[model samples]
Every structure is written in structure tokens, then in C-alpha cells.
Target: MTDSESPSGRFRIAISAWEARMSLWIETPTVLDKTTGETLLSFKDGNWSLDAARWLSDSIVELTLRKYPGNHLPVNIIATLDCANRTARIGEKEVQFLAEVESALDNALTWRTVTPPPRAARSGFASAVRRFFFGK
Candidate 1:
């Protein structure tokens, strides 16, 4: 989901259909404290867009699952960041290790665990263009 509520809370995550098959993904989560109104996590991507939100969420879920195979991933893991005034599920009876959860997500992202270059961006168009421009 898009964290647009805070101007500085623009971190994002992304996953692709092809990547889904590989059982991998990517994401960046950022949270802003409601009471103090301070950004708790990094939101580096300023130009991040909504079209990427679905992918981001998917990536985050996949990353989390991959990183912590035995861990039970709650359906509302992401929404938990904004479930209430707290950026984290800290000191909660339900979410025991909120900080650890966030830390794992950051580690996956920081290490570039799953992000591979988009193949479409690498395909050569010069050959096709040459064939179209010249009969040879």
C-alpha cells in the first residue's frame, strides 16, 4: 500500500508476475509516528507512484516470506504499520516482534536480495530498427 499520508513517507516495494514464479520480490517500508509526527523509517523514493503499490506490497510479502520461511505472515502485515497511531506494532500482544519484522524487511531491501534488472529494458531494439529501415 502507498504511504502517502506523510510527505516523507514515500518508501515503496515492487514485485512482477515473472518474479512471482521465482518466489522472490522487493520492498521498502517507511512509517511516520502519529503522536510525535516523525518519520521512523527511510522513504528515499520521492517520485514513487501508485502503479507500483501493488507490486511493492507483493514484493514485501514475498520478501518477508522468503526471509522468514517459518514465520506466520499476517494478511494485514502491511496495514499494521498504520493500523493505529503507532508506526510499529510495538508492545502489542498480537504482534510480538514488530521491530524485528521491520528490520528483516530492511535487510532484504538493503542487500538487494531479489531485485533483478527488468529484461525489457535490456532487449536490443537496434536490430529490429535496422531491419525496418533497410531491406537488408
Candidate 2:
């Protein structure tokens, strides 16, 4: 569930990876304001690809928090190929937070929470409509 709809939406994040299992998992609540018409989302590996060896270097850890990326916009992230159950704990967080994106991630083909909120459930009914009519 990306923001219901917004006027000035944006996203940003900073990712510095090393070959290790300690992939940083950052999250925040209420990124969107229904009244403002503006959206902001933060996620891991914004515009950058993560190395599997580095993201999953250690199996013992669950999730780790990293420094915030500060201000930015439209950090479009591509989805991961092999999900490997990387999002089970993320669902746990969404369940705990009762986040808007939980349902979106639940139905996603890839690891839901690792990517940005906009990336979650990116292919929606609108996409199908666009493909059908516009042939995009």
C-alpha cells in the first residue's frame, strides 16, 4: 500500500555495503501524509544493487539498523531476484506497526520490506490497465 495518493512524493536512502551478513534494515512509520499530497519513502540500496555475499554474510544476525540517509528524493530501487525469506522479520515489523505496506509486501514476488515502499507491490491493477491500453 503505497501512499493512497500524494502531490509531491519522494524517496531517498544511502547504502554502503561490505561482504558481510549484517545487512542494514532501516524502517520508519507514517512516511506519507494524506493531507499533504507528498510522499517520502526510505529503503535499503537506493538506486544501488546489493551484493548477496555482503548482504547475507552472517546468518546469525536478524536485522540491524543503520544511519539515516538524510534528505533526498525518488530513490527508486529494483527488486531482489532470489527472495530467500529475507522479509519474514520485516513482516513481523509491519504486523507490529500495522503498517500500510504490509499487505503490499505480503503479496509481492520478492522480499517485500528490503526495498522501498513504492517498490512494494509495484505491479498493481493500474499497471495491468496501463499494459493493456498503452502497451508499456
Candidate 3:
């Protein structure tokens, strides 16, 4: 953590875009992993995926592995986040989900970004992967 950041990640969540400062995170306490914070994904056309995955096997089997993640997660649109009220609204829907914020951070790292090393010369496998993907 930086000198300005709290050891326990006690800081406000501020994401500013389009000249707007939206607060999706209050002082709910979260450790900001700079690795994840360095990269962000968006719905821009540049990020579009049009091709379908080709099947490898002719037969499909269902696996009951209790090790997967949830699909219907509580993702707020960030219209307004009232920390005092312990509530947030998603677009026009004012849904009351995640009564406790503790559970949010437990898996927040999964949704965070990882910081990439500087564009300067990097050593080893990471640099190889970067060159392969980024054609640097």
C-alpha cells in the first residue's frame, strides 16, 4: 500500500469518468491491489468478442463441481452509493442486495485489475507473454 493508502484499505471508492465522480465504494474497507488496478475492462467495441468457441469433444458431460463462482452477482450501476444508508441503486432498480459488505471484498480481488510492469525491458516469461500478446 502507498503512504496515502491505509494498511487495512480504509478508503472511499472513487471512479471518475465522463467528468463524473461516482462513488460505488464507500469507506467499506478494501485493499487496492495495484496489479488489478492497473488494468480495466470495458464494453467498448474494441473489446468485442464475435467468434464462438469450437467444441473439442463430440459428447458433453455435466460436472457437478462445487467449486465454481456465482453468476448473478450484485453489480451496481453506480448512479448513487449511499454509505450512510448502507445501500446502493442499480440504474432504475433500487435492489437491496448484499446486506453485509464484508462478503463483497472477500471475492473482490477476482474482479480487480492487475498492474502490468513498465513497458521498459522486462525479464523472463512475463516479457515473453507480453511480446506474444502485445507484439511489442
For all candidates in order, the CA lDDT equals 0.34, 0.30, 0.29
Which lDDT tens digits does candidate 2 get at residues 1-136? 1111112322112233333235543332222233433332234233222222112222111222222342222232222211122222332332222232334332332332444556444388998898799986
Report the alpha-carbon TM-score of model 2 versus the true structure.
0.18
Top lDDT prediction, candidate number:
1
lDDT string, candidate 1, 1-136, tens digits: 3333333333332322222226533234444345455544443432111222222331121112222222332312232343232233322323343345455433433222356676463225886776678843
Off by over 4 Å in 1: 1-3, 6-27, 41-79, 82-93, 96-98, 103-136
> Tens digits of per-residue lDDT for model 3 on 12-100?
23222231126321111121224346211122212111111111222111111110122223332122233333343334445353243
lDDT for model 3, on a 0 to 1 scale? 0.29
Superposed model 2: Cα runs more than 4 Å off: 1-23, 34-100, 110-136
In model 2, the Cα lDDT at residue 32 comes to 29
Better of 2 and 3 by TM-score: 3
Which scores better on lDDT, 2 or 3?
2
The C-alpha TM-scores of every prediction are 0.26, 0.18, 0.20
Q: For model 3, state the Cα shift of residue 76 in Å.
A: 11
Number of colliding residue pairs in model 3: 5
